[model samples]
Target: MITIYDWFGYELPIKERYQLIKKVGFDGVLLWWSEGFGRNYYRDAPQIVREAGLFIENIHTPVQNQNHLWLDNLDGESLTDCYLQCVADCAEFEIPTMVVHLPSEDNPYNTLGLNRIKRIAEKAEQLGINVAFENLRNLANLAYVLKQVDSLRIGFCYDCGHHYHYYPDDDLLSMYGSRLMALHLHDIGGSYSQHQLPFDGPINWAAAMKKIAEKNYSGATAIEAMNWDYKHLSAEKFLQEAFERAKRLEALRLYNP
Candidate 1:
């Protein structure tokens, strides 16, 4: 199925946004499971999107203080609790997967972080949900976590923009493609990690899709594009473009060559 991030740079009401997403021909949406967007609104987002005739592909947990999962402090403990709660929330909402961002930059991997991730994975396994750890700047930390936590419920969420911008030489899909559970497809140009639509930047779409296809990933072809650069376009127009790109991505995945 084709999906896009829910908060794709629109200021409209959540219902309207969801309706527009459905109207533009997307099959599902990836929601941010955080009160940062507003407590009640986000809490009700699953029903809202479902009522609008869209599927909840997954929920991305808040990334704030994610680094605390590594530190041996009260804050780290708090963050672990927060992630466990997020896993429970996925169970409550019936979301099959939860995309997570590990520590930012080059944060060191430690037993503290490994134990917290193990706890979260245990919760996920018990609750029948998948936790997908996204790739960031440091590959070693991610490698360590994935290696140490061998839960079948623990998987990887591949972000195209992040891999291109942060670790271009590393073939992340090859390393963790066997455990791939979700995707954050976007593009980057110039310097920073710009979450632009596919083909809007320098990323090699054919190559990326080829790698994913090699893994036999049959999950939603999801885009996490933001609207920062396309502020001039109307929401409908932006989403229409996104839908087209999503279809293109699917076609690429299906192509043998």
Candidate 2:
């Protein structure tokens, strides 16, 4: 069965986040750095996720850490060292993939991010973790990053919404199915909004997912949504709806297995 890790940022407390995630009906929770999952978060979250019959494990950057990991002209050895540390920490349990983002598109020439990713991939190989590269706002930018980091451990986290933002059509996604490690499933207009739902927005995700399955893209299909109207729908309630949403998507026959 497919699962969604209710994207709970640093806005709410851990206990509150866990409670809501369970109420929402998801069997997984993707925690970010900003969500206060440092030493304390790491220690406490595992138990809670297990208690709820959910898996607790995910990678996210801190607010100070920049959601966009700007891996440009930095000491390669040191950056790699730090990434190795993070991977080891996640290896404690309930972790299988490290979701990451790219740097600025203006200077696409920089290989810093690629080098760091390679280092992390190497480290992950030892820790038994996968490094999932997210498709940024620009496809060209992501393509360049992809061109640089050519490793089996370092794979793509296709953002269906981004494809729609640039342009719609299954053809756009067909080109990268071979590299899919995970998917940041969301919807976009014919423009740039990182997060939205397929039914709520304009991106043709049903088509994109079709290619993902056909290609046998064996990886996590994570719903990387950021927006939340916790007013009418609390995190607990929302999480439940999210699972149903995934069920509907599956019934759509996007993924063959």
Candidate 3:
């Protein structure tokens, strides 16, 4: 069944974070595929999450200054190599999906990006994992890359906050509706991609939620939001609010498609 998940970070330690997320009524946790501190601390992630009685929805690949993947000046190893390692790590952890972001708007959609996605798609196919490319400021380029790859292993990850902030006039879900594999559910206001809790921002939740239901999306209804905006609220209070909001959003899944 499609379920809601929360983003799990190393903020409050692994076990504690997972327990907190589970207690907040999240069905699962989305993990970041990090090799932090050079010790491969994430090697034990699966076990920790499992012990916390929470399932992992997917893993997010590294994206720090990742435009080099589509740049021509990369001498040898580039950020794409790290992302590939992330894919391998997800396969090893038995995670079914991984979310990826492309270079920022500074980089154009070119052959290099296409080839890299081709390679990643091949690797994902070999390992039986799905690679869902996210939309940032380069929706057209992403559409181009997706069309070029033309493989089942590759799909789209729609981020509501990003769409609200970057391409309010564009219908991203309609563009890649059939290829939808994942979601980064959040809310945003006029300009910044706030990643705020839904209904707190100005996005048209009714229309967006209707679109999601219309697509008949049965994958993870993952909330990619944070409580940083509500620093004054206690951790327990914030989580309770988040859980309530998630429940409201999940109810939208029942809308007639």
* lDDT of each candidate versus the true structure: 0.90, 0.60, 0.76
Number of the candidate with higher lDDT, 1 or 3 = 1
- Taking every candidate in turn, the Cα RMSD to the unseen true structure, in Å, is 1.3, 3.9, 2.5
**Which residue pairs come into collision in candidate 2?**
24-236, 24-239, 24-240, 25-240
lDDT score of residue 33 within candidate 2: 37
CA deviation > 4 Å runs, candidate 2: 8-13, 34-43, 62-82, 111-113, 166-172, 189-194, 227-230, 254-257
Pairs with backbone N, CA or C atoms under 3 Å apart (clashes), candidate 1: none
Best first by TM-score, ranked: 1, 3, 2
Give each model a TM-score. 0.97, 0.77, 0.91
Cα RMSD for predicted model 1:
1.3
**Better TM-score candidate (2, 3):** 3
Compute the lDDT of residue 93 as modeled in candidate 3. 86
TM-score of 1: 0.97
Angstrom error of the Cα, residue 153, model 2: value is 0.7
- 1 or 2: which has the higher TM-score? 1
Best by lDDT: 1
Q: Quote the positional error of residue 8 for candidate 3 in Å.
A: 6.6
Off by over 4 Å in 1: 37-40, 190-192
Candidate 2 to truth, TM:
0.77
